[model samples]
Target: MAGITGIGSGIDIDSIVKASVAAERAPKDAQLARLTTKTTTQITSLGSFKSALSEFQTAADGLNDASLFGTRKASSSDATRLTASAEKTALTGTYRVEVEQLASASKIASGSLTGDSNLAFASGGKLTIGLGADSFDVDVAAGATLKEVRDAINTQLNEKGISANIISDPANGTSQLVLSSNKTGAGNDLTLAASGADLQGLVTNRPAALSEAQNAKFKIDGLSLESATNAVSGAIEGVTFTLVKAEEGVSTTLTVGENTTAVKDSLKKFVDAYNKLITTTNSLTSFTKVGESGEPLTGALLGDSTVRNVLNGLRSELSNTAAGQGGDPFRALADLGITTQKDGKLAIDDTKLTAALEDNFDAVGSFITGDNGLMNRLSDRVDGYVKSGGVLEQRISGLQKTDADIKEQKADLETRVAAIQARLYSQYNAMDSLIGQLTRTSDSLGSALSNLPGVVRERS
Candidate 1:
């Protein structure tokens, strides 16, 4: 309700009512606003911290695999003639490779027919095509054209490594049906059999093979080898040779060696990622003086025990030695040229690292990614903070709950402040009405006395 303003009592009742309500509400509003700001800041800070920790965990996990150290690179002296690839199981060695003859696929063609490619057959029957252990049948309809037979065979037998096409000879007015195999190996020849007289002409009196099926002949270290396909594997352990062309007399070298470059790159990546994570944590927990005689500004995660604990855990793991060592030289990260700096970040010595990888590569793998190794321990520690229901997650959950409660309190404060304002308006309006009534009563008495011949009205 609107209160009377300076009426009858000559006082600003609305202003007085406003002042009273404000005085009643000022403290509570300030308290809730401060709580809201503080809670929101904490939530944002924790979120950033969690993101940094998760990123660091990913870096650690990348280096935690033993296979990364066992990776091998295979190379051939003559890349155009032959190329090779190696797996982790490949042994490091040098071998001479000689590709003798490349494998070939088989193709067959029927005797020439005395008509155009569109000539219709007298009758049709079941035509079965076979390649290796796979075969498919095509039912040729009576009076079917040569083009129709080729289309039907292709539609059903393309995936089975068999394809059919019509080779037309326009000069002689004759056409021949040709069948080919996609497989390149011995005993994988294309075969055609028919059951009807019209289809028998395609199989019974066909010419010799257009190209004979043959196996790949190659030699590794002067040991003769044969493969059904051009891609030869298992001749050399963990090495696959893709024979490009036949180089019968020419010899090439295939060298299998440790992929030390990959390992070095991964290590460098881990170092960079670790440093980036350290920078993030430092920023989140920093404090600085703003100006002369001004208040100092603190970071959102300053003095956070969770951050302290996480850093401490990782640092402790980095400083620990790997397990089960009997005077092994490369037993820790320090031995592999990784060291801690004054600012608590990792530093890599390139020369020392390369030497260590060259000298004892397997030992380097054992120290960094073996059982109870530094990366494994560090990754485990990070898991405690970023995993579901972990420490950081629980902390964030609690802060969210507190924020929700603060919101409820803010809502309640608004309700109470409104009730106070309404009551003050009602009370002040009633007081103004009473004052007006009292002034009217006094004026009536004074007029009666002045008219009774003894009292006179005075003017000031």
Candidate 2:
């Protein structure tokens, strides 16, 4: 096939074979190309739709929580003195908080030592450190330096809430072993006991208290409260306030109120996500002019009933009243100023929406997050189409099978084309051989006639 195919026949046999094969392959190849393009387009369209649907569902689900509606905002009059945060259970009120004392951790330092001093402990020595009820023991080997003792205590007893460090004074050029408790509060102090002479000198016997362990003392609404740490919670229900600094008689006022801004922002996000989904679905199901030739181009999902059903279902759910809006005036999304536009997207009336949320927040929330609420209904419907083994997945799976079938057909057609080419080459070669034989016969007869003796005598 690679060499000169028509050399023996003096004919363009290669061109003939190519022409025959092309004629047979043209229709089948075109069909496969069209099918391939269609399947790929469908897959891409479905994937885009599913992605947009997923985002929309997530936004809707955020608003589906009841606690979000009851969100509370906490503010401190003097944040420098205190900082506060409130949960959904926190009631709206003002409280006077006075910080009596900020908690301090227990810190102890050992006697000074020379810089190059290499001190060793007695053999089989053990250092036992305790913090409240928790205790841990560190094994001390003979000839262990101050650094070694610090490292062993840190690496071995870290889980027991103890830290060890060797602090060096630059002016004196002396280092001492300092031990501190990881926790704060009265009774949560570090108590060290050692069996070796060196270990006892470092932790047990010769120790100076750098800072005393103390509890956080503060007053909440004229009621005194004490905590192990500055971060005090449960002193007031659903509220946690951190005591930054204590100024006697300087009280900070903390106010807890409804967080309407968060609710409004959440609603806006849901609207934006829903609009995006609508836009995506519209484009995928629309028709438009394709190119300069002015041919009409249909969308990949045009005339798809699955797309139509999903859109219709969502629209219906959005228009209906929520389940738990028994006597509330705002039962449907439309009541809260969310209405359907002519282009199938949702538009919000800011004035009405704001008034609805500000005037009757609880009622509005009930309408949207109730059992049969718009978000609940929409969430369920979208899940049916986008979830695994759902409508969109099934459609994509079918298109993939079509792709496989197209490949098989293409391979079979190629085999047929090759066989046809072989047949054409054989026929042309036989015809060329017959023509050569006839030409040879004619030359031989003409030579014999010219050599005849009678013809030569006549010419003289």
Which segments of model 1 are wrong by more than 4 Å? 1-16, 70-73, 76-80, 111-119, 128-137, 166-176, 193-195, 200-208, 248-252, 259-262, 321-326, 341-343, 439-460
> Would you estimate the TM-scores of all the predictions?
0.83, 0.82
Over the full model, what C-alpha lDDT does candidate 1 score relative to the true structure? 0.85
lDDT of 2 by residue, 235-325 (tens): 8889998999998788999988777778888889999999999899889988997787888988899998988888888887887664443
Clashing pairs in 2: none
lDDT to native, each model: 0.85, 0.83
Candidate 2 residue spans exceeding 4 A from truth = 2-4, 7-9, 67-80, 85-89, 112-144, 152-157, 169-175, 189-208, 257-269, 290-293, 321-326, 337-344, 347-361, 456-460
Q: Summarize candidate 1's per-residue lDDT along 300-375 as a digit string, tens digits.
A: 8899898899888888777776453886776567888999999988999999999998889887787778557778
Best by TM-score: 1
